[model samples]
Target: MTMRAVRLVPALIILLVALTCASLMIGSVSLSWIDLIKGFIRQDQTAALIIYDIRLPRTLLALSVGFVLGLSGAALQGLLRNPLADPALFGAPQAAALGAVLVLYTGTVEALSFALPVAALGGALLSVLLVLAVAGRVAGVTTLILAGLAVASLAAALTSIVINLSANPFAVTEIVFWLLGSFEDRSFRHVAMAAPFMVIGSLLLLRAGEPLRALTLGEETAESLGLSLVRERILIVLGVACALGGAVSVSGAIGFVGLVAPHLVRDAVKGDPKAVLLPAALVGAALTLSADMLARLVPAPTELKVGALTALMGVPFFLAIIARRRGAIAADAS
Candidate 1:
C-alpha cells in the first residue's frame, strides 16, 4: 500500500469506531459510556441487554451492510465504467427484496429460514442480469440509468402487488418493512444469517480489484493483460447478489450507501478501483451507522426509515451526477 493509503486507513478505522460508539449511545434510552463499561466489566443485565440484544445487532448490521454495499458500488462503477453506478441505482436490492417478499409473503416462510436469503439472492442475480441486458451490449450511462429505473420500478410494483394481495395483515406489514429497509428489531440471528454472505461477497469483490483496475483501460487492454471479462463480470454480479441479497433479506432495502460511499473515497484512492474497496467499505460503515443513528433520533412517535432518509439526502447527489453525465454526453456529441 502507498504511504498515503496506509496513513488514511488507520484514520478511517478510528472514525468508524467512533461512529459505532455513537450509534450504540444514541438510541431511545440514551446509553452512557459508564453504562457500556459497566455492561462489559460488571455484567449489568439491563445495559447488556440494551447493548448486546438491541443496539449491537443493528449497529453490526449497519456496518456489515455498509461495507458490502460500498465494496459492491466501487466494483460496479469499475465494471460499468460509470461514476454513478451502484447496486441501488441498478435496482439490485429491490429485486432481492422482491425475492424475500415472494418467500415471506404473509410471513409464509420464516424470516430466519434459509429460503429467504436464497430466494433474495436469486432475485438480485436476476435483476442485475436484466439491467445488463436492458442496458444492451454498448449502452451509455443515461441508457443504463433509465433501464435500471425501469427494472426497479417494475420490481417495486410487483412487490406492492404481492403485499396488496396478501390476506394476512401481518404479511403485508412484513413485506412493507422489507420494501422500506430499516435496521430496527433485527437480532443476532440476522447477524449470523448475513455474515457468511458479507464475508464471501466482500472477498469476491476485493479479489476482482486487479481485473477491475485493468478494465479501467478498456476491455482490449485488460484482455491483453490476462484479465477475463467473463470472470470479472461473474465475480461482480455474484458478489453483489450474495452480499446485497443477504443484507436486504435481513434489513430491507437500504439504498444509496453504495452510491455515496465509494464516491466519498474515490479521490483518496487516486481513482483506483482496486484500492478503493477498503476505504469505501469503511466510509460506508460510518455512513450507515450514522444514518441509523439519525433514524433513531428523529423525534416522532415512530422513527423514519433509514432508506427514506438516504433517498432524501442522496437525491441532490444523484441530480449532480446526472448533470455531469449530461455534460459528458454533450461533449461527446460535440
Candidate 2:
C-alpha cells in the first residue's frame, strides 16, 4: 500500500468508529455518553435494553452490510473494468428482495424466522446463475451486464406483481415498508443470520484481489499470465451473490453504498482496485452508519428509512460521476 492508502485506512476506521458510536446514541430517545456507558455496564436496564437489544444489532448490521456492499462493489468494478459497477447491478438485491417478498406473501415469515433470509438468498443465487447462463461461458463485460439487467428487470416485475396481487392488505403494507429498507427494530438474530454469509462472501471477494490486478492489464493479457477467466468470474459472482445477497436479505434494498463507496476511496488508493477494496469497505461502513444515524435523528419520532437517506445522498454523487466520465470521454474524443 502507498502512503496515501495507509493514511486512508486509519482515517476511515476512525470515522467508522465515530459513526458507530453516534448510531448507538441517536434514536427515538437519544442517549448521552453516560447512559451509553451505563447501558454497556448493564446498570440501566432501560438504556441497556435500548442499546443492546435494539440499537446494537442495527448498528452492527449497518456496518457489516455496508462493508460487504463496498467490498463486493470494488471487486465487481475490478472484475468488469467498469467504474460504474455496483453490487446491485447484477440484480442480487432485487432478486433477494423478491425472495423475501414471496416469504412475506406466503405468510411463512411469521412462522419461521429464517424463512425470509433463506428465500432471499435463494433468489439472489438464482439471479446470479441466470446472469451467468445467459451471458455464456465466453461472454464479455457488455454481455454480462446486459444479462444482469434483463434478470433484474424480470425479478422486479415479478416483485411488483406479487405486491399488487396480494389479498392481504396488512401483508402488502409490511412488504412495502420492508422493501423501503430500514435498520429499525432489527435484533441480534438478524446480525447472526447474515454474518456468516457476509464473512464468506468477503473472503471470496478478497481472494479475487490479485487476479483483479492482473485483469487491469486486460483479460487477454491476464489469461497469458495464467489466470483462469472462468474461475475468476465464478468466484466474483458467488462472492457477490453471498455477500450482497445476505445484506439484502436482512436490510432490504439499501442502494448506492456499493456504487459510491469505491469511488470515494479510489483516488486515495491510487485507483488500484486491489487497494481500493479495504478502504472502500471502511468508507461504506462509515456511510451506512452515518446514514442510519441521520435516518434516526432527522425524523425523530418518525424515522426515515435508511435506504431513502442513502439514495438521497448517493444520487447526486452518482450523477456527478457520470458527468465526469462523460467529460473525460469527450475530452478523449476531442
Best by lDDT: 1
Worst 10 residues of 1 by lDDT: 325-334
The clash numbers for all candidates, in the given order, read 1, 0
| lDDT of all predictions | 0.84, 0.83
Candidate 2 C-alpha lDDT tens digits along 1-334 = 7999998888888888888888888878889999999999999999999999999999999999899988988988898787877766678788989998888786656623666667887888888778768866544545665787898899889998998989887767777767777888888988988888889889999888889999998888899999998899888888887887678878988888988999998988899989999998888888888888888778564678888888898889877876778765454344
Alpha-carbon error at 302 in model 1, in Å?
Answer: 0.9
Error of 1 at 44 (Å): 1.6
C-alpha lDDT (0 to 100) for residue 313 of candidate 2:
88
Tens-place lDDT per residue, model 1, 1-334, is 5667777779999998889888888888987999887765647788888988899999999999888888888888888887888898778999999888888875667879878888888888899899998897455677788889998998999998988888887877767766787999889999999888778888888888889899888877888998888878888899989988888888889888888888888887788888888898888888888888889998988778888877776778878777867878665344
* Predicted structure 1: lDDT: 0.84
In candidate 1, residue 136 scores what lDDT? Answer: 70
Q: All candidates' TM-scores?
A: 0.96, 0.91
Angstrom error of the Cα, residue 134, model 2: value is 5.2
Name the top TM-score candidate.
1
